[model samples]
Target: MQRTADRLLREPLDCYDDGAIEEGDLSVIRLALEQFHHAVADRRAVIGTGSTDIPPMQARQT
Candidate 1:
């Protein structure tokens, strides 16, 4: 999960804010995502699960 996050940060993804996201803001987003995923993993680890099935984050195109 961490690897995927890192790759995503390195790749070019869209910013829904149009032009609101600046160069400096990327690090902040990256750090936040890292922390969030780490926390999720930690929480899942405590639950004695063989694997964690994280749901995909997608928006409905209705």
Candidate 2:
């Protein structure tokens, strides 16, 4: 999954503008990428824990 995230981050921004995406479309893409980055970070944090260690809870208090 990190590999996929790397690919996403490395991809050319021009690719997203190929069809003249509207402002709303660009916003959506930005949000998606941000979410993807967060998920990748969370996955890495979990995997960094040693086999004998428990993964940390990630829930936020409201």
Candidate 3:
């Protein structure tokens, strides 16, 4: 899911014209991405540390 979100964000938006997207639809996309990343981060906060002995801060810094 995180990989999917990353790919979605990394994708080029220039393929679509500015006028092609409605303002409300753009907001929904932004909100979905925000929620997806947050959900991934929240899961990682728990899952990441348990699988490894590394501390969260230290693991991130490295």
Candidate 4:
């Protein structure tokens, strides 16, 4: 979970260089945002603040 958060919140910075972003970087950013949204939804459900329709994110096996 922590790994996922780090990837979503921090890793994207690596995609930037000299204040410019590339197409591949945009794809990475999109995926990270989508995963982050799922994480938030999962947390909300766990705390009874959201519906269960949103499936929980699976931890990646590193």
Top candidate when judged by TM-score against the true structure:
3
**29-52, model 3: which lDDT tens digit per residue?**
666766765666677787774332
TM-score of each: 0.48, 0.47, 0.49, 0.46
lDDT-best of 1 and 4: 4
C-alpha lDDT values of all predictions: 0.60, 0.54, 0.51, 0.61
Better of 3 and 4 by TM-score: 3
lDDT of 4 by residue, 1-62 (tens): 65766666554455454345554665666576677677877888889985646555453332
Quote the RMSD, in angstroms, for model 1: 9.2
Q: Which stretches of candidate 3 lie over 4 Å from their true place?
A: 6-18, 49-62
Tens digit of per-residue lDDT, candidate 1, span 1-62: 76877577644335524554565666676566757666776788898765555545443232
User: Considering only N, C-alpha and C atoms within 3 Å, which residue pairs clash in candidate 3?
Assistant: none
Q: Judged by lDDT against the true structure, how good is candidate 2?
A: 0.54
Best candidate (score: lDDT): 4
Q: What tens digits encode model 2's per-residue C-alpha lDDT throughout 1-62?
A: 74875586444445444544443555655666667666766676888942333335332232
**Candidate 2 residue-wise lDDT at 27:** 61
Q: State the TM-score for model 2.
A: 0.47
Residue 43 of model 1: what lDDT?
81
TM-score of 4: 0.46
28 in model 1: Cα distance from truth in Å? 0.6
RMSD over all Cα atoms, model 2 = 9.5
